[model samples]
Target: MNRIINPVIPGMAPDPSIIRVDEMYYIATSTFHWNPGIQLFQSRDLANWEQIGSALNKGEINLRGTNTPAGIWAPHLSYDAASQKYWLTFSHMVNMAGREFNADSYIMWAEDIRGPWSEPVYLTSIGFDPALYHDDDGKHYVAILEWETRTGYQAPGHIVIAELDMDTGKIIGAWHRVTKGFTTRGCAEAPQLYKRNGYYYLLLAAGGTGYAHGVEIGRSKHVFGPYEPHPSGEPIITSSPQHLFSLGDPDAGHFEMYNPNSIMQKAGHGSLVETHTGEWYIAHLMSRPLGDKLLNPLGRETSIQKMQWTEDGWLQMKDGSNVAKMETEGMAGLLGAGSVSHDVFDDFDQQKPRLHFMTPYREQQEEWVNTTERPGYLRIHGQNSLFSQVNPSIMATRATSFKYELKTHVQFHADHYSETAGMGLYYDSNNWLYVHLTYSERAERMILTVLQAKLGERMEYVHHQVPVPEQQADLKLVYNEGFADISYRFEEQMEWQVLLKAIDVSYLSDEGVNGEPGEIGGFTGLFNFIGSVDAHQHDSFADFKYYCVKNE
Candidate 1:
């Protein structure tokens, strides 16, 4: 039997919501503050997946000033057979201060997956990770986490369910409080309801989103009831199954729960799907940290597990192990067709950037970024500095592998100190490592240098500045095991000169930043970005001939 490697859809694909629409399988994952939000992928075999398109590309919502891990979360995708449409429900997290976690849920539909979706209809402000379940009777129900704010109550809140009017986007009845979590591990969220064999199964993500994360389950005869937990009294799937009882713990970074022996950690937040052949499988979020540091620069990724339903109707991993595996049994004859290439080389000859490229905190607009402005080159007008949470003119793609080479050729001229353009690695508004080109008044020429931000503190590598002779240059970054080696060369020079070598950028990982004290600093993974900053006049722009990424 062919083996399917874990992380079928890799890099920053957290909170996976998987569904099968006939023969094709689709998965939608949380995008957080990245605009063109709600990354969607389609897979034929569970082993390989391809990004088809995004759901929120039409500016349905504004994410300006959105904090890290606080924009679009937990996008649930479902197909309505009665309406013959695809339904998407997700939460827009607006605030995380004081642990209020203020969020508003919305629902939308589309006749086609890659589509002009219907305008977002307001759903509720109950909590995050809202999912829409369509029952066989044509009735619709919405299940979400009812955020608890009481001083002593269950920290992250309860999983609640209610009838919903699909046409008006209104809750038809009172919200019924179900279970806080199915197991002793707390921080339950991402509730997705499914019916199997006359049983309503409620799947939830427990033990926060860190090392202890896992998938827990409960079932009931009715849509809402006192659901019975799995008979094992534990998570059906997890990376670390050493029995953790972290009830009432709201912290998302459970670093203490890291399993040293497991190659895949933080494996949970699963979405279930049954294949056309009736084979059961689950698409879940997992992370591969760098070495033993437990620093996940790629953030949470999507993995698949072959599942087996016991005669008693309980779900379990096929091997009867709660521990997530790095490799599992793959569907026969489907492996070869599912393979996809990760290499990308965009010459900007087209009208728009590739669908895989995403911007932060703002929608992609032609006014700030366009290819027509300069034929054969993508022009991006500088807006705000990378430190700003508002608008940053950056075209970025997820860092899909630990070892990769990112290459780009850009032409930019900066007159002021605040004007700079180049490419580097980004985590959020507060953390990044940029190797940019800027004009040095003292040298009366363009200079290249490295700037880094860690925990919101800025550090400049002024010693590594290299004077450029022309307005354009070729830049490259070689990343291997959390370290970056930056190189640059002029068009005339065939050899690439190393400007910065072995720069330990491991701080760009999720565990390196500081968030709301106890919670995880960030959930989105590191991104390889080509951006420009014009804090001086917002008029400077960078024209790039091509952008390329080759994964090793």
Candidate 2:
């Protein structure tokens, strides 16, 4: 049997909610502040995955000026077999200041997954990570994290359930407070309902969103009554299986729970699916850091673990270990569909942008970004600066690997000092590294310069003037681990020369550029993009011949 790699869908795909429609498996993750909301992926054998399309593509919601880590939360995807429709439930987290945690949840449905998805119907403002469960008797239920605002309650609160009307989006009854959590790992959320052998199982993510993160489960005979924890009272799955004394601590980045022996960390928030062959597997959110560091540049990614039920009916890893693995055994006799292909090369010859391409906060403006104006080149008209959440003319793809080379060829004419176009690593509007071509007032010609943002502070450090007779330049960013080498050349015939070498960009990780003390940092990982800025005027645009990402 072939082994499946962990992080089946890599790079910022977190809070995964999965469902199997026939032989095909689909996973939808939180997009946070990024536009074209929920990043979605599809797979056949639960191993090789492909990013197919986004669910919130048509401005169904407004994310303008949304803060990092505070827009779209966990997206729950499910199919109602009776209605023959697909249902998606999500939360729009609008505020976290003072930990008020004000958020509104909504639900949408469609007959097909490649959706003409219905407009979002309001669910409730009770909490975040709302999910829908379609029961056997045709009753629909909603489960969510009930935010605890009172002083004496558990910091993040309990998992609550209530009956819901699928058509009208109305809660039929008052919220029933279920278990605070299955274990002592206090910060519980992401509750999903499932049934097996006359027992109703509630799977949840516990221990917060840091080192102690884990997947725990409970079961009950009744749908909304006293649920009992698994006999062990320990998590069914976790990256750090070792006992941690800080189980009830609400603080995140419980660095104390960091398992030195494990390669994967922060493994939790999982969704389970059963295969056609009767095998059980879970697609969960997991993270990998740079080395011994807790900083995750790729953010929380999706990983799979094969599991089996015990004679007692409780779920356990197939190998009988709670620890997460980097590789797991594939289903027996199941040769998966052909490996999903990633479009790493874009020659600007296609009529539409690739599915992998994404923009920050707002939808990509077709008026500013187009390939039709210049047949062989992608024309990106300059917009707001890269730091703006408004209209930044940046098109990007997730940095899937730590060691990779991103190259792009651009022809830019900057008449003023504020106009620039180039390629570099981006995390969000407030955090990024850009090596752009701009008119250097001192050099009297187009010059290459490096701009860096550390915790929202922007700084310009190194500069080099391009040699004369050079209009179009080939730019490359070589990232090996946490160190980045940014280089450029005037002509393709010329060798790549380093403009900035061995720059320690480890600060670009999730921990480095986080929000004010209590708020979570950017959960979305690093991206490589080619964009332009027009602080002087919107008349300037850069034409790119091609963009390529090669994993080293």
Candidate 3:
């Protein structure tokens, strides 16, 4: 048994879907507005996982301008035994205005793991968090959270199961609503199907995707049923379990519920898988609060808990507690897989850019991204400011730290007017900080500047213009545990002068960062963005020499 030493997939990698094919395990997470969407990970043992590539690279689905936390939702991965094809179903959440919660679901199929996947088939007009089950009768059924908006019906409605003809894109069966009572947690989503012994066990994610989130289990004697709740009378694993019938308890199933002793917080929404050796594991999305009550600074990440079957057939945590973090030793040998890998530190030595490059919005404009732009550098053109939610042409990776340094070098041959372009930190359309170089119109001197904006707020702060006698410079940002200090220097400067404004980086935390009221949460960490913004479009391009991040 191994407890997680470090959470591998951090930041906005929520609603995780995991499946083990043969000897290896693969996981896919929701990629909101980021292009080259659908992050895929591969691991040998359950403890470590590394990002491999995007499953939606073909520009398969459409997201007109869906920004953060809006593009791709919870993806359910499953393998069809009869067709021998791996299937992925997810919600392309298109709009969230007035909280109308507009979304359409689609399914993609692939035979090989590194897929030249099939075109996305428009599967349902239903709702998000869609899961697929290939029943023993060779029928394909889709389960989803039909998002509800009525005054009486609980939000996200109920978990509905229907037969979907993948070939014809139509529903064959009536929508069977499984759990409707408020205590099942009005938002029962992520319905998962498992066939064991003589029953169809459905594991569902209930409660809003918030502090109250947990996994619920119901079983039917048949594929479709008036399913009954598990016997223990509570969720199997959750942070807060129900003793009273209030909405505040963390959701869980009953058998061996709370460990009374574990350190992890609020764990639930688990997807289960059995290894080649017949032992079981649950790959679920859970979060770690930074201090106390801090929205996950890194957002919802994936964690695995070892599980085993009880004498009565209900799955129990290996330690026999409803808690989800206990380690189950010696399971790697059962899966015949190795261990998870390390973080990728790539500098693009190959012909094409490394797979980690992500453009916001669709991969539409080829002119914006090119690995061949330079020998060692990946070039992503900047079209607009940190202001526009659409077409930012920004490429970023997970911040992964409370204290870290990001630095980059750039050369700008701008027109007399197309003032600036350089590097910065990006958190969605609203928050950003860029260290750039621009020409001083009054002084006739080439100057360095820092332009930062708090939210999508229109007012920007341009730090005092300083002299940069040379053409190129290195811009650096030291994000200490809770504050950000930016500095820049010319070709051979010895000392770096800090800018006047030192932003309190803690404001970027889960609860502090500003977003739409109840609309966007701040667990998603910031990204280093090398940008080119020409408010006075006089230049053809701004060239970035290289971008690097490392600790002293």
Candidate 4:
């Protein structure tokens, strides 16, 4: 039998909420600052997963001008057996300035997973990470983290629960404040309710979202009451099992808690499910930092660990340890991982683009990107500059591997220097490294140039430029351990020549951006994209023949 690998879903897919309906498993994760709000994935064998669709595919909410890591937060996916419907609840965090996390939560339902979802019903703006639970007694409840803004209080406030009227999206009674947390690892959030063996269990993510992150558990006889901590008085699962000096520090990159013995870090924010065979497992968020450094370019990913219920009626890791592993036992009789591949080679021949493609800030305008107009090619009509939060003609996918190569062939005639089209690595509009084809008055032809934005500072490195005789060129970027090599070739038959080699891109991680030490940096990972820019006029377009990505 084959073994199961960690990170069932990789690259910026965080705060996973999972559910099992019969033999099939479905998960929903947060997609911050991306157009299609919540990412939904499906799997059968627990080892292989594929993206089916997004929950918020339509234009219900506007994400224009949304800041880094502050759009759609944690999304909870639950199924009601009686009603035969699937429910999804999530928070749209608008702002996080001055630690004032103002957000509005909403709920929606559908009959099928790939669904015509119901319109979003407003919940509240009290906090983030809202979840809906349907009890056997036909009652519904909502759990959230009531954010505390006043001084002299526990930093992130409490985990509260209340009866919810599903029809009206309103709370029926006063909010009942549960325990601040079961232990000293504060910043308790992402509350999930589970029932097993006559007890209502509350699972939370605590110790912030840095190196000290973990998942803790508590139980109570009643749905909303005084919950009791686990017997261990510590996190039930974590990447770092040992205690750290920075317990209450809100900093993101808590280097003190880095577990040198483990490959996974920041394991927390989990959602649990039980298989048809009565086996237990938890899908949680984990990160793999650059070798020995605090930098994480791939962002938080989704990982799974086998779980078991102890004799004392508490859930714990199957190994009786908190450290997350790279490989684990597979489901019984599951022979092979499925053939759903993450790598892409789109030749612009399909009627609809691949499911993994996503745009920034707003939804993709069909007029700007079209494949029907030009057969066998994707034409991107340039709009605003990449720095603008409004309309940037960019199509991207997650950067899934640390050692990978991305290549795209494009044809564009640049009348002025303002028009450019090519491929690059993008974190956001404000932070990216682009190698594009643009008009160069000095060279009097189409030339390749590099543009970089590091923490809001934009600069054009002129030395990494080469003149091309033809209007069509191939752009390639290779990334390895926080360093990127940019190269280009003029023709399909020509050999690739290096333009920039071993450029330090460690600053593209969450710790490198300029922001508040603890609360400010970007949480989204890197992306590989093909885009265009028309500063002079929005008429110039680029025709892309193909886009391919492969792990090196």
Candidate 5:
């Protein structure tokens, strides 16, 4: 299945929440900054998932102030059979600023998938990854991993289940703390609750969300119970078929760290979905190491594998395999087609923005982004700088390829101030490189300048100017690996002149960028954007004639 089944959704699409409603399978993945947050993808055939929309597009939840590796966490998508409503539960990680671990869980229900969703109903305040359990008892329950803090003597955290009041959106009982130190890895999260035959099973992703991550299982006679970990004491599903670290970071799990003789690594934190075809598959997160050195700048993405519950009530992959590298026989031909999209191209005639987009603190306003400015072009108004968490005048799509070229044709008038708007690859506002068009003070014409920002340093990387005699110019960038060659031409120039040539872009990687300790930033891949800054009045409106990438 490894050869035929690759990650359908790539690039930081971790902590997948999947559910099958009728003939359709709807999936929601965690979005840190990418807006239209909680990207909703639907597929008739599991293999061909198309982004229907986002679960949280109303901007009811704000993630701008939410810190890196924080923001919107795991979102579980489910449908209530009794109520006939679609429900989604997710953590609004509000307080990463102090590492205070103050996050709030919210539940929203709608009659339709594309919905006028009900206002957020508060659920739990103690945990981050929250999943719902609906049993035959007609009772609703919520299971979560309550976080561990210094104030508590609980070591770190334990699994907690409580009677959930869906009507009032409250937990009716004390959080039942069960299954401690059960996972060989100290961290057990993304609990998936279910009941089969006579046992109530709780499957969890164990270890950290890293290389040694695995899937562990425990069950009880009751929802909250005297649960027992699997007797094997190792994850049922893991890439490295060894006693790897189930605890902290790789160094912490450092004891079990070794190069696995396989193509997939960091295969953990999965969600299970039972298909209408009566087959079971795991839509778990996995990473492909660029060089196997353990630095994953691309972040965890979703991969699928087939599994079955044993007679002992434990779910296992076919042939009792050690994370099968070959195709497993399960949902054969039950999948769908691969949606062929070029990594570089923005046709103004898309249903919504494609799967790769996000607004920082808020959702992109239709008022701000309108194609009505022109028939074949996109027009985005200028707002604040990209650095500010407030609404930035920017709309971007992800950089999906290892080797690709992104080009955009944007027309913007720069006024008295150094109002510049152009296109280039962006990670975060703190650290990014751009080739923007600005009005040169010395020269009367608008000139293209290389604005390379290195976070809060206030010093630009390569800020030389170029004269673009025309208002409209084509800005193109060729990112040969990390290093980039950015240039611009006004149809008058025969050749694409080199603007900022041969810049070592490895620093843009997670390990290279400037971030504090314990925080590896920007799991999301590179993105292309056209932005505007008017420190003065309203001086700029970026008219994007077209945005294309050399995805081939």
Candidate 6:
């Protein structure tokens, strides 16, 4: 039997919500602070997946000035068979200061998966990670974590369930306080409800979203009742199978809980789906650190595990092991299926940016980024600097692999020092490595140099500056295992000259950046971006002939 690789949908696709409708399967993941929020993917064979489109591409939400891990959180996707519509429920985390975790949840429906969705219906401000369950008797219920603020209460709060009026988007009844968490490991969030064989199952993401993360389960015969925990009293799925009982710990890092033997870390936050072949699988979020340094540069990724229900009516991994695996048994008939190609080569011939391209903290409006401005080229009018949280003119894509090559040809003319255009790697507003073309007043010429930001401190590599004879240049970045090499050439036929080699960029990872007091780091992954900055006049723009990313 063929094996399905871990991370079926890789690279920054976290908090997976999987479902099956007839033959096709769909998965939706979180896209915090990245515009066009709620990344959605479709799969045919479960082993292979493709990004179809995003749900919030039409300026339905504004994320300007959003913090690192604070925009759109765990998006729940469901299909209402009776209504013949696709529904999405998500949280807009506005504040994390003082651990208040202020968030507003909303629900929206679409006639088609990729379509004009209806206006958002305000749900509640109780907590984050809200999900909707459509019952058999035509009743709709919403399950969420009622965030706790009391000094001594169980931190991160209780998983509550209540009847929801879909038409008015209001809770018709009082909230039923469910279990804080099924397992000893606390920091539970992301409650997903399911019904199987007359039992309502409450699946939760426990042990925070870190090394000790896991998927815990509970069940009840009635929708609102005293639920019973799994018999094992432990998580059914986790990266680290070691016994860890941190009942009230609200910290999400759990760095000391990192499992040394497991290749996949932070394996939790699972969503279940049953295939057309009657097989069961769980799609969860996992991460891979950089060479045991415990720094996750790619952030949390989506992985699949084959699941089996035991004789006692409990869910577990197929092999009766709680440890998540990197490769698992695939479906018998759909073993060797074709997957979507990840290599991107965009020439900007179309009217809009490609579906995969996303901007930071703002929508990709045509006024700043457009293809019609120059035929066969993408014109990006300069706006704010990369450090600005609002209105930064950067078009980026997820860095799907540790070993990949990003290349682009740019035509930019900068007369002022603050005007620059280039391509490089980015994590957030505070961390990045940029190789840009800017004018040097001292040298009286256009030059290329390297700039880096680590924990919000700026550093410039002025020694590596190379004079560009023309206004356009070919740039390339080769990344391999936490290091990057920057190279450029003036013409297409010339050999690429190295500007910098073996730059240690491991600090760009999740655990490497500095964040809030109790948080681990930023919850976002790295992105390859081509952007322009004009702090001087905001009149300069960059024309890119092509953008390509190829993984080795």
Q: Write the per-residue lDDT of candidate 6 for residues 1-552, one digit (tens) a residue.
A: 768888787788999999889999999999999989999899888888888889998888889999887899999999999998899999999999888999999999998888688877889999999999999999999999999988988898999999999888999979999889998899989998999998999999999877999999999999886899999899999998888888878757888789999889999999999889999999999999988788899999999999999987899999999999999888868657644567778999898888889899999989999999899999999989899899889999998888999999999999999999999999999899999999999999899998999898999997999898998899999999999999999999999999999999998888888775545788789999999999999889999999999998
Estimate the TM-score for candidate 1: 0.98
Error of 5 at 483 (Å): 3.3
Error of 5 at 55 (Å): 1.6
Model 4 Cα lDDT, one tens digit per residue, 265-381: 999999999987788999999988899888888888999998999998999988888787887767776787643456878999986677888889978767888788788998999
C-alpha lDDT of candidate 4 relative to the true structure: 0.87
Residue 264's lDDT in candidate 1: 97
Per-residue C-alpha lDDT of model 1 across residues 1-552, encoded as one tens digit per residue: 677887887788899898899899999999999989999899878777889899999898899999877899999999999999999999999999888999999999999998778999999998899999999998999999999888978788999999999999999979999999999999999999999999999999999988999999999998887899999999999998989889999756888889999899999999999899888899899999999887899999999999999999999999998888988888755644445677778999888899889999989999999999898999999989899888898999999899999999999999988899999999998899999999898898999988999888999997899898888889999999999999999884579999989999898888877675556788889999999999998889999999999999
What is the C-alpha local distance difference test score of each model? 0.91, 0.86, 0.67, 0.87, 0.70, 0.91
Lowest-scoring 10 consecutive residues by lDDT in candidate 4? 244-253
The root-mean-square deviation over C-alpha atoms between each candidate and the true structure, in angstroms, is 1.2, 1.7, 4.0, 1.5, 3.0, 1.1
Clashing pairs in 1: none
lDDT of 2 by residue, 89-133 (tens): 999999887778889999999888888889999999998999899
TM-score of each: 0.98, 0.97, 0.89, 0.97, 0.91, 0.98
Full candidate order by TM-score, most accurate first = 6, 1, 4, 2, 5, 3
* Evaluation by TM-score, superior candidate among 2 and 3: 2
**Candidate 2 accuracy as lDDT:** 0.86
lDDT of 6 at 487: 95
User: What clash pairs does model 6 have?
Assistant: none
| lDDT for residue 536 in candidate 5, whole number 0-100 | 61
Per-residue lDDT for 422 in model 6? Answer: 96
| Model 2 residue 483 lDDT score | 90
Model 5: worst 10 consecutive residues (lDDT sum): 249-258
Q: Which segments of model 5 are wrong by more than 4 Å?
A: 1-4, 151-155, 245-260, 324-330, 333-344, 349-356, 458-464, 510-519
Candidate 4: give its CA RMSD in angstroms: 1.5
